[model samples]
Target: MMLVLLLLIYTSQHALAVVVEMNAGEMSVLLPCQFSGFIPDDPTVMWTRNDLVPKSVHVQHKEGDDFQGQNQRYRGRTKMRPDALDTSDFSLTLRKPEMTDSGNYTCSISGGRGERTLEDVELQIKDQQVEVKVVEGSDSVILPCKTKHDLPEDTRVEWTRSNPELMLVHIYPHKSDQRKKQDGLYRDRTAVNKDLLRTGDLSLTLKHPTERDSGGYICTIYRDKDILRQKVVLQVKGWFPPWATALLVLLVLFVVSGGLLFHFRHYFMSVYKVEVDSGVESVLLPCKTVAHLPEDVKVEWMDSDDKKVHVYQSSSDHSDEKHQVYRNRTEMKRNLLRTGDLSLTLKHPTNEDNSTYTCTVYNREGNILLKKDVLLAVRVPQVEVDSGVESVQLPLKTTLHLPEDAKIEWKDSDDDHLHVYEKRFDQLEQQDQVYKDRTKMNEDLLRTGDLSLTLKHPTDGDNRTYTCTVYSKEGNILLRKKLELKVKGRVQVQDQTGDIRNRSSSIDPTPLMADQSV
Candidate 1:
């Protein structure tokens, strides 16, 4: 019994500490160590790493902290509470932790009799992983690596490509603007922000990305002896973009034979094109067919990644099989089979929703019935208005008649309510203070189907993405649109009108698709 009790005490000491994981660019991390019970007179607390040279990370004695023997690598980057020994809490605070700081540390106390191990801490600092994808012939692409904390002034940022072959991409704070020491391939194609250290944005911009530019790039920020790194994997697609390739193929087919052009157009119709603003409430992926489907048919919608988006069968939605990302966010009409409409409504559509979706219908016998493809493109439109204009109108024209009890709201990207229209009238009490009396809407917006908001005295501070959302009486989202307002200084009113006119003209009014003979 005595030996077993000693073994349990030893096991508890090892189990007291835990593995701590953090990113390399984090501000700080804590390695916890605590001991309770009677105090040992003249005790000396030590935190040391076995693999590091000199080993000692931090030392606290009855006389106070003894840094005379601390490792040079961890001299000024570690700290402990002033009353740590009194409170029996000997936790170590590590500042600006980097990948090189990953190691196992042991905390032990030494007294007049001997020494006893308290706990062991395992730390792992990992590099952030970011994947960027873009098509060839693009004007530019940004590899993002940002931190909330501003780096030291003496820090230097280095961007390099490691895979395939080691090469220098870009470096900040160099003497020359041309970056003469950069690799030949990225000499003129690579650049970084002018004030990256101050802004904490160490992103690298590559111009006209091609297949050769696809590789793994690392952004390393060095300050004194500490180094932080983030890795980004870039993928550049085909020689020609998908849109350009499709247009070229269509032209060739039209020139070769009219019948071939017709066939290709039919195929194209099967693939619908849908474009919406990034912050829309939801978007519909239409898949309607006139042919009567089987009573026991199964409908499934899958994204480009082959993940299930929505599924329906036996006159009910099988939401249990949906992907986690789409859970509680997808809906389909109950009478889809009877009406031959198999549209899927995805809520809170974002830029990540920009993908090709496939809708397939299978009969009870497991034979395919119909298949359709939809490509969703979520975009943010820009609206430029002169700073000194009397009022600028954020235009939104829809033909659908909104519900009488629906609520129409205009909010900025900051989530501030700019204007609110509810219960058939403007709700001034709900308007944000900054936009209290500077906003207006059409008196009969719901009836006229013109839900535009006019803002008076546009200023540079008002330059932000504005979202207009209409909600039903049941709190269900009816419609949503996002518009980026750019308040330009010293610009003529005519140019602002031209900008709005051009943006309004760019709206596509054609039907998504027409019923065809199956």
Candidate 2:
């Protein structure tokens, strides 16, 4: 009985000291040991990294039993999977492995059976660097799957194009570091799709593109553990076709042909007709030349006598000798090519100044255009007056004067209304009205320009104003003068003394008789 008990204890001790050989990359390798030898119920399981020693052990207590492990990098990341705990599995699961986590790990537990240790668990961690591919101009590009694993936060991504003509447009952390060439045509027209930075999408787009942009491109991912590369072929198609090119050429030809036709019509075929107002103080003679003509073209103006009246050369400074009667008054309306305001101004016009004028434009290529026979007319009007306030009484008549062609008419001051004079020239002569007998004029003095209308019996009522108006042949009222009628002296008075003495004598006869008796 003693030998059987001893043999059972030795088998349990050998089983408790079993090796926990963990082959690298296994899902969850069991640390070839169990807690059944200790307490069949709850027992502590512990693990530790040899690199971290005792200081980095993770400890867990179940009732009075304790388990511990020293793995600072894997501190809370290790746990006994709940499903495996019921089967005496004392194995720990690493949530995610990193390159820095490769080392030896051990599991130890102290309980009712005895203190047991599982040694030399070679935890070999490897980084499966994933393959990423970037297909240029494809639907999309994918980043390497290695980025999905646990990696250092400071890891960087680099994108490069394998083709010499193609280049990296932009990258994160730096915009200026993006590959660019001074002589490249797309120098400023490329940009990256920055919205997908989180998911590791590094894509770029070109603006106003051409087919030459199609080429191979590369995207390289740089991590602390490894580096990754991807290649993509970009395919491009022409935006414009052969038909579009032909249409563009035709459009340019049509524009040039139309411009030439317009130039021919303006320079060789167009005509301008000019008319000037008669009797004006001066006349403006307008002349227009083709806008395409050079600024150095010379314009000459000539009168009917073939005398050069004015000369305008754009290259020469302004001179009075080259100007017509009105110096500095003649001006082009606007810049030569803008508006043909070659309208000239004349000053102090007269009848002799009326004639046909000619405008000739000459360039270095000889006479280019001409405008002929523009007529200008000047007019004058004669002055005459048809009215009569010919004369007044002695004192008033002395202050009056008249012109040679004056006519006379008479009317009473009270009857003088504007409409009263609207009678026929002959009817005025046949009238024997109140003014007929009262007024007269000296017929012989009229030839000497003396229009004196004498009033026979002038009275105070005649003290009013009379107008003498002179008119031009054009019916223009040229001159007007007003005459005032005046009367001099006072009136005589008669006495009523005798009748007043008689009335007083009859009313007071008693006082008179008393005075007589005394």
Candidate 3:
């Protein structure tokens, strides 16, 4: 229940509206209220919120500030100006403000018979953070920022970069925006829609983001005395930086000058170009080293920024200080580490992960041993399947030959087996109840890696994730692929979450196949 109580206090009186803005979880607040003119001896001042009972927030009496009759909730959390005659200052102070503390506050003063209201203040808190990602040297990057509350046309919006360098990125004050106060690097490379400000849009359009342009940006909005704030962190990936390219060219020259002596050694360095569909559920960034590692070897994997993505040592994973967003979603095959395979599996990757990942292998003595650079290229799949009643064959055929003793497992969104082929036989009894008899797989073609599954009748519930896991004779995970299953057999309908969909599709009798590009 909301507490709001007002008993006909307005009698042809104009109350001045003042807005005091701040984010939630603040330590304290000062509500401004003052009156000009003469005072009668020791004046009686009272600060109150109509919604709060007893109507007493703070009182200034001749005995020097009292709160004996004030509401207990705000008894010791409020303050007001003591000198009302000479300074004519009257403002309420609140401590430990929260989201629920946002509302209307009234300051009424009564002394020597006459009573009048001083000011009506409205305090607000803005709480939201936006993220933006861009490819280095891309055409432009747009940062979306909008406040739940509306802003006046003359509201001021200022953009500033808080990381790498503290500088003014852009500004719009006195009803118009200009680059005069903006940093020289961003003067001609930025623009914002002025008309959009009328609808609470403080979005900024940054043109042509370079390598140095990646960092945190702050957007401060001001209207009259009210203030709102937003923060955006932009990540720039891709593009060969000029410095790194030059160093690479120098390395080539150094190798050529030495009569191509290290040419043969280059063959030993492993490089993997892993590519996957943009919307895949997961992807593997392959990393391996032929050099034998000591038991206490420290392994580190990092992004282009040299930020630690994963770390391992002493036959265990140490993930401390890992980036907050990528903390728990990263893992490695600990069972295969002793054999020199240091592949990192990233779960639920987005476009931001479409960058270079450097795998650094270190010896027990902290000496650099081997470095493998894995370039991850993410793009939409080439084939597009339309959802309809027609049978859709999900094309998944591999060139690798499967041995007779190979193992394969097909799973749905729930990680339950939809189909399983192991020991040269089809095990339908091991499948989940939802796909008991509806799944079909050709066991005779198992030797040709034709482990595909076809659904007898696809339905709306089939629109979900499906994965295929293959293992070698040694029980090692040979390959894994995840695909999205959709259905369009029924009419378009909206679900309880307000999402409308027409889902239906058929898989080509083949089980899930590994993502093609990688």
Candidate 4:
């Protein structure tokens, strides 16, 4: 018994051990192993993963490489040097690794005498995390999935939700999408690119996504024996109107209309409603005042959290005193003091930038001189439609009736006027030529408050952001909305059986858990 124990210990010493780490979407990774000294003729090299059935990962002999006993997961993804045994190098190359491929692998060698352990390799594969947030009433949202490798033509793509519950969201097999087995919750709500494999962009578009649809989604691509997966988290927030603030604003307007503007001149500050897309490079916070102020006064902009956004003093900019969140991202006009236009330009504004900003002017003694408040709503609601559709509508619904003399204008990101309305009628004189006859609106939009624009014959060129602005006769912006339009090419799919084969070892999804080390 002692001799047998000694022999086992001796055999363990011959096995070289190593560990490798790689991300899930990577192209390939190498498990290294090297042996020196004599190599017998007609030798055999074998690799196996103990936990997997049909443990054979790869095998090679004097004849050539063999796959008769290999596991289905490693059928077409495992490779080694042609002259591995002759050179005593028994490394293996794994292509398109996935989260399920993390484990321990054993390598062995045999010849005329007997078999012996060669090496042991431990692999750890991790998935990259991505998060996307959208408002509850958005038309659609995209869960992006991009891969580096060129997958096979016959690859099968499967999108599944693992968080909250295990469910199948979408599937594309062979050359078309299969929806029969899709979860009822995602029925008629999911779409993918027509030529995903060719473009390497397998982004999944979810239409009319609600808060219930928010969760962790896994996009798994199956190409023959290889499985690649990536994870994305989606968050949908519900919209709630601030009723008290709206009532206060109405009271302020009532007081101003009663010729009491002079009484509230020191207390009332004009509010400007600014809406912009999150994808925009910059947004201007308008705070113009005609009141003359002391030359030694300081202008400071602050967010709802009272964090300094931008500051100007001593006849120059003082960005060092701004909050770290706005560092290097806030700018002001050079002649703000001269022009009395204390507009703050914020760069690369995101969802986190959505809040009310206060601009306060202070004298040399730190006493408030004048103040203005600007409410910035950075929203980019996406609306996707197929090019085959006859027309697409940019929806904007408000319960309150707009001013009768208000001029509503619809303009694209390129400054092209898509539609215009003034004096309760369509104003086509200033409309862009490209949208002269392609745009339409309701007859009494001022009363109905449904300023949705319908664009006929949507095409790829129509893919851009459209901004809707309502201005009163005094040239004050009353309302603004930004909507992103995506016109995708139509996809033609035929009814056929989902050509699925060589599914991953763990076909049924397991709950997203912490990473395991082997």
Best by TM-score: 1
Candidate that would win on lDDT: 1
lDDT of 1 by residue, 356-419 (tens): 9999988655656678999888997888876667999999877767889999999998899999
Which structure is stronger by TM-score: 1 or 4? 1
Residue-level lDDT tens digits of model 2 in 198-295: 55555445443334445654444544423343444555554346687788667656756676645443223344333442223346776653223335
Residue 139 displacement (Å), model 1: 51
Misplaced by over 4 Å in model 4 are 1-299, 302-377, 492-518
Off by over 4 Å in 2: 1-281, 289-291, 315-318, 323-329, 384-518
Instruction: For residues 1-518, write the lDDT of model 3, one tens digit per residue.
Output: 12222323342122346777665544566777767766666578777777778767788876678878888877567876656545878777789876766777777777768877777877776465566777765668898777766677677888888565577888875234464456555655667786766677778888767656678787777766555666787888766566877886787767766857355444334556677764455689887653335455677888887788898887888878677656776899966544668899886565457778998877554666567888777653332344444444444456666677888888876888888888878888898898878777765766565666676566666776676767778865555555666564434445778787664434432233456321
The sequence of per-residue lDDT tens digits that candidate 4 reaches over residues 17-125 is 4556556776677777678756677788899998999899999998889999999999799999998877788899999998999988888888869987777777769
Q: How much RMSD separates candidate 2 from the native structure?
A: 36.1
Residue 119 CA displacement from its true place in model 3, Å:
1.9
lDDT ranking, best first: 1, 4, 3, 2
| TM-score for each of the candidates | 0.37, 0.22, 0.35, 0.29
TM-score quality measure for candidate 3? 0.35
Error of 1 at 205 (Å): 63
* Total colliding residue pairs, candidate 3: 14
